[model samples]
Structures are given as structure tokens and as C-alpha cells.
Target: MNIRNLAATFVIALFGFFTLNLGLDYGLRNTVPHVLQRRLLNRVTADVVAIGNSVIASGFDVAAFDRASGMHSINAGLGAAEFAQQYVAWKLVTNERTDIKQVVFGTFDYSVTNTKPTKWTTWHSNNALPFYADPSWSIRYGCASRADEVVYLLARRVPLFTERGGLWTKVETLRRYLGGVGFPAAQINRFGRISDSKLLLEQNTEVFERLGRSIVETRVPLVDPVADLLKEAQQKGIASFMVLMPLPADRRSFYAMPGWKAYVVYLRELLSQTGTRLIEATEWSDSREDFADFVHLSEIGAAKFSTRLSEAMQCAK
Candidate 1:
């Protein structure tokens, strides 16, 4: 090829690459993790920052928690988010406001396993990519961690491949969220709350039952990373708490999965050794109506749980 033609081609490729990445970042606004990034940047001060997966996001009643505890609070939960992503978010929030006094991490043993379905790109991990110092930093790490996103970036050109890459069902999620036309019963309200509604009628009746069938793995990929985060929190005199939020009555059978009980025991022991408080949902209450689905808490359920949480924790009130 002629030198001029080669130079033109190179410029086109670079421009295309940047455009693709920026589009994905813009589309990510539909997700909880992307919104959390904006939340982290705002000069929002809080005494407590609740961090976890969607369960925590839906289950923790931020308004109730703040009112009952007498501490300003915000929920920094992300769907499918695990420890490393949350730790990074913790750093970003702490960097912005030195006032965060406590961390409430709602998690389960099953989440720690490194058994994501092939082609899934976790939002917790993906959302952090844009925060890198340069574009290449995110592209390099993103491709390394989850190449499927790379495929999805290009797949939009193919007629048959219309589905979104990563965990997204479609690209409309971003627009739906950004436009404030979120799902029927669940919309992102104040403090990132996703209020429960009958509009979110259960589609998969067997979801919890399916979860019950999966064997729970005992391994945690970010063990040391979490330990390090705890150490840093301790240094700053910030208290850390972990909540094993409840599963629906029928799906609570997940506890019976082989090794799951042991995993819980291991987690409890690990938390005790690490000096973090552990709260099991069954310890104080077990209301069947609290669950929106097999895993998440309904709005009423979250309010009840948060009240109980405040009543139980000395630091909370």
C-alpha cells in the first residue's frame, strides 16, 4: 500500500477503536456500577457506605438506615459485583471524602467463586476500566479480563448478533436507565434505591430452586485483596461489617448444598479472625414476605431488615 493510504488506514482504525470504547462507556450508564462511579466522584459525604451486589443494593434501605442509625449513608451496591471491584470503589469514595466511617458489605459464599459463565463480563470489573489514566489502560485490561466485550464491540455490525455483550441483555439498558425510564417496579431512586414493586412480577419461578441445585464452592479469588482492604479500614478507624442476606424460604435450601455449610463456617471464621462483624439474616429475623425474589429483598423487606440491623448494631445507632 502507498504510505498515504497506510497512514489513512491507521488513523481510521484508531478512531474506530476510540469510538467503540466510548460508546460502550456511554452505554454502561444503564448499569449500577457506572452510576456508582459518578456517585463516587460527587462530593457526597457519608458516615456509612453500603457496598455489595444487587442484593445489597436492593436489600439495604438507605433512607431507613440513615434515619434509624442517625448517620448519613449511601448505597454503593452493584449487580454482580464482588470484592476487588468494591475495594476499588471504597478507595475512590474514601479518597473523595475522608468522612466515611463504616462499610457494610452484603455478600454470600457463592459469589466468591471464580466460576463465571464463559463470555460474561462482570460490571463491577468493567465499570472500573474507564477510571484508568488512559484509554489503552482500560482496553488492555478489559480485553485481558474479558475478551467477550471485545467481540460484542464488533458484533453490533452483524445482523444476527444483536444482544449486548457482558451481562447486559441488550444495549437499551443504558438508555432506559439514563432516561429515568427504568424497569416497571424497580427504578433508581434517591440514594440509589431500587424500590420493590409488583410490576417486577417473578418470571422464573424456579430461579431459587436452580440456585439451590448448584454446589457452592469454598474458594474466594480476592481473599488477600479483601484482607488488605480491611487492614486499611482498620488503620483509618473505619468499622467493617458483612451481612449474609437471606434467600427465600424455599431457596434457602442453598445452605444445604454440599460444602456450603462449611463455606459459611469458613467465612464466619475468617471474618472473626479479621475482626469484622458478621450478621446472618436468620439470627434476628426470618420474614417470608421480605423477599422480592429468591435472593433480593422487597422494599418492605429491606425496611424491616435495615431496622433490625440498626437495632442490633451498636455502631449503627
Candidate 2:
């Protein structure tokens, strides 16, 4: 082809790409779960907000907690979240309303010690938090760098440049449905993607022990993102508390490990410094029946835990 024809084709292709990218980006911005979450955050009035990962996503029954505590509550838990995402959720809620008097963070050993930002990992787009997160807040919390900010801005304009976890999650759901066409339906919780449900079974005794040891031995700095989150909550006059949610029966054995106990002691000291309270509820429910899988609580379990959590807060006060 002549240079004139090639140039014309290139321009047309680029235009098509931009058109498609922007179209998808617009649709995604309106359709994702964060749109609904943002709407809720705007109007949500609560005395307490629960923030964390899948554990709290499935474990914190807002209705039960409200009923038990005699105070309104909202669960802003995000699946696949760490402190970075939790901090963003905190910012979103606090920025929108002044009713939040207490912030309850649900955690496990792995999450409590994880200082890295979610944007640095493959799970960045595991949920719609990235789409809703403020670019400046992300950088302020060390969740995203300047390069990441550029990419985030590009994603806002052209979502095709962003991670495709949401689309891939849908594709994976379809694949799982096709594969399980004739089998008994798997009991899955609503907190995370169906594709990730099997992850619970993979965390065996050995894996739990190793993870515990790593968490205990990891040299975390005195003030990391988790502490930063607690400190920020305190600065806003919102009391912060971390609840160590209960695990499955056998998995709770790790709590008895020497390293695990030491980690808890260290964690309590850290929380004390930040004016955050640490609630140890790991042994609250020893029944394997309470868990949906390995770590997340079932509906029944959530109701029980939420009530107990309310009482614990009352007692602490």
C-alpha cells in the first residue's frame, strides 16, 4: 500500500480503538458495584462502619450488629482487601458523613501484617475499589505511585488500559458454570467471586502454619499503612478497633502457635500506640459449622458474630 493509504488506515484504527475504549470505560463506570457503593456511601448514616477483606465482607452482618448494639451500622467490607483498600473505604465514608463514631476492622494474621498496597498486587482490580478510589488518596496512603496515578487516570478515560479482572471474573464464572453443569451446586458465599471459593480448601494446616510463621517473623516497621489507617481514624475522632475474626475449627490451631501469640502481643502494642483496640475473637466460635469455608463466616455465623461483636464493643466502652 502507498504511504497515504497506510496513514489513513492507521488513523482510522486509532480512532476505532479510542472509541471502543471510551465506550467500555463509560459503561464500566456506571455498571460496576462501586457505583452502587458510592451511592450508598453518599447517603449512608451509621454510628459504626465495618471495613476489611472477605472475612468481614461475609462475617459482619450489619443488621444483626445494629439490632444488638442499638446503633446503626454499615459494613463497607471489600473482598480481597488489605489495609490499603480498607483505608480508602474509610476515607470514602468519612469524607461523605460525620456520623461514624467507631470503625471496626476485621482481620487475620496475614492481613494485619501486610503493609504493601493493593495496587501493587494482582488483586488490585479484584473488586471495584480501584474504580472508586481517589487517585490522590491512593498516593497519600502509599497505595499507588505517580506512574500508577497516570495509569489510573488513563483507565478513567480508557478502561481498556486498566486491569481486566472484572471481565475475567465474569468469564471465569461462566467457565465454572459450564464445568459444573451436572454436579451438585457448590455452596459459595456472596463476598467473593465464585472462582475464588476453592481457595479456602487450599489453605491446609501446613500452609496456615507457614503463613503464621512468616507473619510473626516479618520485620514490619513501627508505623506502616495499617497503623497509618488507625492513626487517621483517631485524628478524625473516630475510634478504631481491630477484630481478629474467627477461623474454622482446625485452622484455629495456628493461634496456639508460639509465634502467633507473639504476633498478637506485638499487634496489641501497636494498636495501643494508635489508640486502637484489638479484640481477640479467634476462639469465639470453635464450631466448624459456623464457617462457610475455611476463613469466611456463613450467614448463621455472621449473625452470631455480629451480636457478640456488638456486646464486646459495649463492654470495652
TM-score of candidate 2 versus the correct structure, residues matched by position: 0.85
List the candidate 1 regions with Cα displacement exceeding 4 Å: 1-3, 12-31, 113-222, 253-262, 282-288, 315-317
Candidate 2 Cα outliers beyond 4 Å, as residue runs: 29-33, 115-124, 140-152, 177-187, 191-219
Model 1 clash tally, residue pairs: 0
lDDT of each: 0.59, 0.72
TM-score of each: 0.64, 0.85
Q: What is the TM-score of candidate 1?
A: 0.64
Using lDDT, give the best candidate's number.
Answer: 2
Expressed as tens digits, the lDDT of each residue in 222-269 for candidate 2 is 335567778888888988889999877776567787667777877887
In model 2, the clashing pairs are none
Best by TM-score: 2
